[model samples]
Target chain A: MNEEIVRLEDAWVHFDGVSVLEEVDLSINQYDFLGIIGPNGGGKTTLLKVILGLLKPSRGKVTVFGHTPEKGRKFVGYVPQYSLFDRDFPVSIWDVVLMGRLEHKKRFKRFSEEDKKLAYDALETVEMLDFKDAQIGKLSGGQQQRVFIARALVAEPKLLLLDEPMASVDSPMQTELYELFEKLRQRMAIVLVSHDISAVSIYVDKIACLNRRLFYHDSKELTAEDLEATYQCPVEIIAHGVPHRVLKEHK
Target chain B: MIEILQYEFMRNALIAALLASIACGIIGVYVVVKRIVFISGGIAHAAFGGIGLGYFLGVNPVLGVIPFSIAAALSMGIIGRRTKIPEDTAIGILWVMGMALGVIFVALSPGYAPELFGYLFGSILTVPTSDIILMLSLNAAIIAVVFSLHREFQAISFDEEYATTIGLPTERLYLLLLCLIALTVVLLIRVVGVILVIALLTIPAAISRQFTHRLSSMMFLSVFLCAILTICGLWLSYAFDLPSGATIVLVSGTAFILSTVSKSIHISVFSKSI
Candidate 1:
């Protein structure tokens, strides 16, 4: 097996005295594509934030590539949920991609040719090279998500963390993005947070069910029994590969 | 115009206008982008404490406003970072405290407080050469720092969390930005005074943001707008026998309203075409 890229041991998070994540334990391997799915308010976003070092775990430790998340920040790229960004912000796609190289550039020095080349390559990977100078706000939802993916790729990170990459995208774009993710998994590990269990189930090698606590599945094929055990509810895996029964009955 | 330049005071005032315009225009971008107009206003008003201190000590008031304004800006940055307290609340507290301190100090000063009124309303017409030089160097330093850290600033301004994920030192960048804002506020006080400086720092940039989509272009447009507004305000003040700071703010406000209205119309027309 490849080296463990992320190891979280009993991580806990609380907000304003309310327990959000409770005793969560998980491990991600190098080049692993891990999908995280749960209902709303199930601490999916918080878990990603904890792994990104944006929030401190209330208990236990989170190690990314054998170092603290903060120390390993440069080695990981992140695409936060699209909702957090005010798309109206004035910045071009090239400028947004250039931000990915900020850590590498020296103070007062302009971006080198090598940096621009890397940015262009990343843009090409996401099929956004033609929109290099386009304003970020003007892009379609899928296009914006792709640009953000390119921004993350520009860093050449060992691990890529995505939050709901498919939320607002059209169905065809979602399929294309999943294909892109499949290609990306060849180069780096990815931990994607999504509510669309069926869509991600085929692309992800493993799944982690989160609802304050975590239930880990090491196999790509998850059954109704697995969903029931993870969610602690009577869940039925519909024939279409979606856990629709689980959502409907649980609600 | 030649006759106006012949007077030493007029030359000093023009130089001060040039320096103040550049500083305010650059720092104003950050203020507008960050939506920290209230914090900037707090810093400006809080510098009154330093002015009062300078009056009590019989020292240069501009020197006094620097440390006081910087302290206020730093505190605002820190408080906003550390606590979930609404930034507006923190700024309001500091704003009142600083102004109260300034008023008390001025009241306790031994001599008649003739200079206090001038500082409050601004006396650009009587600016000295030394103040002009100071303003010039400060503006140069701000421009150099901003230019050097252009990409980092753009990243942070666009999305602070993404900037951090990319390994940019967001905390340091934010502090540096606040310090620059403090420095700019000090220089601009000579032209717009504390009461009206926020408008000078915000109106032009706010208007320019409507017409540009690039950071560099927005900065350039803001500077041009600010320069035009300053020159027009000065001329209008001369002709109308009005307060320079008030005139400048009024002109910028008018420009902002016009830009906003035209932008809305243009967007509506474009949407209809699409």
Candidate 2:
């Protein structure tokens, strides 16, 4: 059996007495590419935060690599939603990517040669080695997203979590990013939250449709009932030849 | 002009200026890059309350400001984080309340404090040897803390959520940064006065940012530029018989305008040619 990299048992999260996630039992394996699909403000980010140890679940247990989230998080790489940062912040691609090695260095210590090699290797994995010297803001949206991925990857984590990775990328670049993730999931467990259901269904090994509660299936195939269960309305799930899941107007 | 260095007071003022510049240059980059100019201003003004309390209590105002400003910085950090009060509103309240407290304390101090104006609008010439030593110690502490936590600071400043997700103790680091800013405020209050501290803290870093994309380079350039500004302003003030602190800030202000305007012009010209 593949090892469980992350396990959340009966997890519940609440903000200001309003429940965001309830009884979300999830288990991610060593090679799982799990796509989490949900509406805006539907506890997706809260779940991600819980898994990353940034927020504690109100109840239940969350263990990563058989340890508490805090201790286990060092082996996890995170690519947050891209809108929270100052785009014009004065940092080069090299500097931004090297930030991933923060946990590995001692106080007042310079980056080790091994750290440098890992950073460059991560950048190369994202095919961004050539632009390592460029300012981050100077890159296109797709390119900046790739740099963020490189930053996350530089730590060589066992699990990878990304929130809205395609939010700013152009439509054409979205497939390329998925392909990159496809390549990455071969080495580590990948969990991504995205609104792009069609591409997610095609590329991910499993899909978790979440609202306040979770309706998880361990395969890309989903019934119309799963769509309605998550969206809270009657909806159609149309599968095209491109391996996409298109939603029809509510009846 | 060279003979100015021969005077004891002149020598103290020069050394004071160098120490103050070191504090501003190092912490000022964080201030500018993090876009916390107003927050730093709020901390500086709130520090005036400590000065006033010191005078009211018959002790050193600098001593009073140390704890007072740290308290203010911490409360500001807490209020900004835990409450629904808009950060700008909270800063404004703290800024004015701090000054109001200072005024009340000074009014209650029972004597005419003539040197109060020197605290508001600094006179570098009046900085004594003891205060210079205090500033030097503060500079050393700032360098030490920043050196040890440079990566954490950079991470939090750039992407705090990402930093937290990676299990970095971001909240504690942020509060520590505020404390450092508090100390930096103390170092600058004697050089630029409470009224002009933010200008000294921000202008040189802003200028250095135009030439460097890295934080370390920005700090080094800011340190150099601040030294130049302080020395030239001191000379000009001596030559014209003007206020040294205000003159130094004005010089920096003028340079800020020139750098910003020239940058815009360069960008436009390059785009037009492109």
Candidate 3:
């Protein structure tokens, strides 16, 4: 197996002639738990989109698993931010997770027993096996988030990309999610993008600051200067306990 | 009701209702769940252009409708997705344009259009055996496509972005769904006509959704409900010598209202008990 999971060489993305991301060069490796911290509209989501092959980078090349993103996306599991879709859609948690096996399915074939087992295993991995038959809409925000994660994991992806997985989660449960990610990191490469810097930094193995351009750091020792550069202001990282604060008083 | 079924026209109408329900029961779930009722409405109305073109060109209206409505659906799908035009605006433009084209084609053809009212408001009582065959085939197509692509449709309907990330061909699946909707619209046009088609395409499924949270159960319940409503409406229309199409729509509407009222009452009762 290739050690390198994703490589972006000077990736650039723009919409309507406006640059959303610029010269972002980064590579993700196996067993890498990368957290991307950026302000809103800093192309964090766009970066993920580029990796998923949803959007083509305007200027540079992006590869996942040494292939084009489209082909490479087969090995990637993605959990988009919660609340981006209609929760009222009639689907059980089992069915939602079964969607992860879509690419693995052959044409004109219904899901096999193996697919069902994988879906169940994915649900179990997220500790949602009890709710497998429950309607997706009936779950709480955090539960739904976990179900979405299970949906991504059902395919047993080698690379996992999540966008703001902690946004809808309650503060009390946020650490639990990070712990889940920590477990997940043991098996696959994980890239998480969020503006919730204070809570995310502790869990990530490496941290990358993004603000249109990216400042890639190989380790989790992110400095206040890097935070200032990403947020475009003076910053601080107060690591007291569960609720660490990455932003400080301006004065 | 037994006596009513003895008449050929009544029997055809009943068969037509059943066929329409099958298509509606399956397709309507997607419409209501995805909230694409407006797009379905647009397709229904656009099918009028096909009907008019059939008359003008001296071809079978149903055959004309298949291509015309499909073309309309493809255009709506592509333009709404690709162009900067807002989706609703594209639907509206295609909708009115289709209706206008129908009117123009009908005007250009010779003779007064007596069946035009049937196409606009439906004449289930006058349905021929040939149209019955068409509806049966369309129902088969709908069932086969839906069953084969059930998972893909579910994924895209729930979260298109996530579906894309999972390597599902979301755009193609979306277009295929639009095409299915177009076929369903054609199936509905014969039962309720263009103006009232959306009701048949959405009401039963909407009602079913209130009772069940699973897609398959919702589909089964909607189909059952639609059949009951269509048959009841047909019987009432036969007894009263009223318009069958309008009667069916009224029955469905009444059912929807009743479901809503009962749900509210149930909620209130539960709250009081709590």
Against the true structure, whose TM-score is highest?
Answer: 3
Q: Compare the candidates by DockQ and give the number of the best one.
A: 3
Model 3 per-residue lDDT tens digits across residues B1-274: 6877788998899999999999899999998998888988999999999999998998778788899899999899899999999989999999999999999999999887789998988888899999999999999999999999988888889888888887888889988999999998888887889899999998999999999889999999999999999899888888898888899999999999999999999999999999
Worst 10 residues of 1 chain B by lDDT: B114-123
Provide per-model DockQ scores: 0.73, 0.71, 0.83
Q: Write the per-residue lDDT of candidate 3 for residues A87-161, one digit (tens) a residue.
A: 788888888888889888885699889999999888888899999889888898888889988988888899999
The residue-by-residue lDDT of candidate 1 on A13-55, one tens digit each, is 9999999999988988899998888777889999888888889
Q: Which stretch of 10 consecutive residues in model 1 chain A shows the poorest summed lDDT?
A: A242-251
Query: In candidate 2, what are the lDDT values of residues A62-166, reduced to their tens digit?
Result: 999999998999989999887878987878999999999887877578889998999999999999999999988889989999999999898899889989988
Q: Can you give the lDDT of residue B3 in candidate 3?
A: 79
Which stretches of candidate 3 lie above 4 Å from their native place? Answer: A241-251
User: What range of 10 consecutive residues in model 3 chain A has the weakest lDDT sum?
Assistant: A242-251
Pairs in steric clash, model 1: none
How well does chain A score by TM in each candidate?
0.91, 0.94, 0.93
How badly does each model clash, as a count of residue pairs? 0, 0, 0
Worst 10 residues of 2 chain B by lDDT: B163-172
- CA deviation > 4 Å runs, candidate 2: A238-240, A243-251, B82-90
Q: Kindly report the interface RMSD of candidate 2, rounded to 1 decimal.
A: 1.4
I-RMSD for candidate 1: 1.2
